[model samples]
Target: MDKKHLQTPSQTIGPFFAYGLTPTQYDYEFKSWVDNNMVADIDAPETIEISGTVFDGEGQAIDDAMVELWQDDGEHKLYGRFGTGTEENNRFIFKTIKPKSVNGQAPFINVILFMRGQLLHTYTRIYFADESSLNASDKVLNSVDAKRRNTLIAEKVGQKYSIDIHMQGQKETVFFDL
Candidate 1:
């Protein structure tokens, strides 16, 4: 990722659109999660800062990259899928609530990144706070090779979280390849 913003194409390649891709709230069930019930909403006015410069293995910020995130309802929602991309505008700020573990399956959030001028759209899944014991038990994280697991986590910094993504560079985030 380069510190300086680079120009990328805004042309739509599929069903998703450009920035501010409105997360359709077609599923009524998703409402529960966005409401104050979910953990991310716990601190109503407290904004969890999710800040990170997308970087390449060489340690350069990738500019003009759009990042989309989706996560499950952290409030014990009986029927939410963590990585399925089913939650509605579960799209809160780029910063999200810390995911929890269930059934020995640690939670994770989906991320879709669009870079300017790049033909390839990158897909990745981000894990919750690594400090939690659940980080050790997350099935998704566990499934990945130990050497690559670190690529899936983001470090939380006070009110802001930071994770630099390396696009077109070595040591990139673990992409879903979808």
Candidate 2:
């Protein structure tokens, strides 16, 4: 009989992977492939900052969570990743340009959240609260119940956009399976 090595079963999501995935955040010698800045040119006129914190069921901040943002506005495709532990208040901050509406859809950024307890990452969107007219016409935004739509909108706080993500509880952010 021939002996074959079998692959190990998949494990739950991590607080372990942070050292490798976000080396800089964990004070490692090497830098991570992606660090929160999505803009290639920081001086770009459209550059903006998006910041937020992830909260658990009990509303405590998730200090070890990782957040990724993806946005494509026909011309530029931007991506950013940030570990909450790197921020003073356990928040994730991304520097990127405000995406333009794509194919008439509301301008939004796709968010993927990774945390220790989650078996799989959660997906969500950050819609601009100021884009009321555009958001109202967006089919995807409208698909979510009107009452719960606010969970996905990022409010303009001073010069930056802010949106808090609730893993569970009354104000839980709306996560999509996709």
Best by TM-score: 2
Model 1 per-residue lDDT tens digits across residues 72-174: 6455332111211233322223534555555677676667776555577778876656455777877777778888787777677666555655654557677
Off-target runs (Cα >4 Å) in candidate 1 are 1-47, 56-59, 74-93
Backbone clash tally for model 2? Answer: 0
Candidate 1 weakest ten by summed lDDT: 77-86
lDDT of 1: 0.53
What tens-digit string does per-residue lDDT give for candidate 2 at 1-178? 6789796754455887777888886788877888888986456687788998999999899998889898888888888888898787898888888899888999999998888898778899999999999999999988998888999999997679999999998898899978
TM-score of 2: 0.90
Q: Give the TM-score of each candidate.
A: 0.58, 0.90
**What are the runs in model 2 whose C-alpha is more than 4 Å off?**
1-11, 41-43
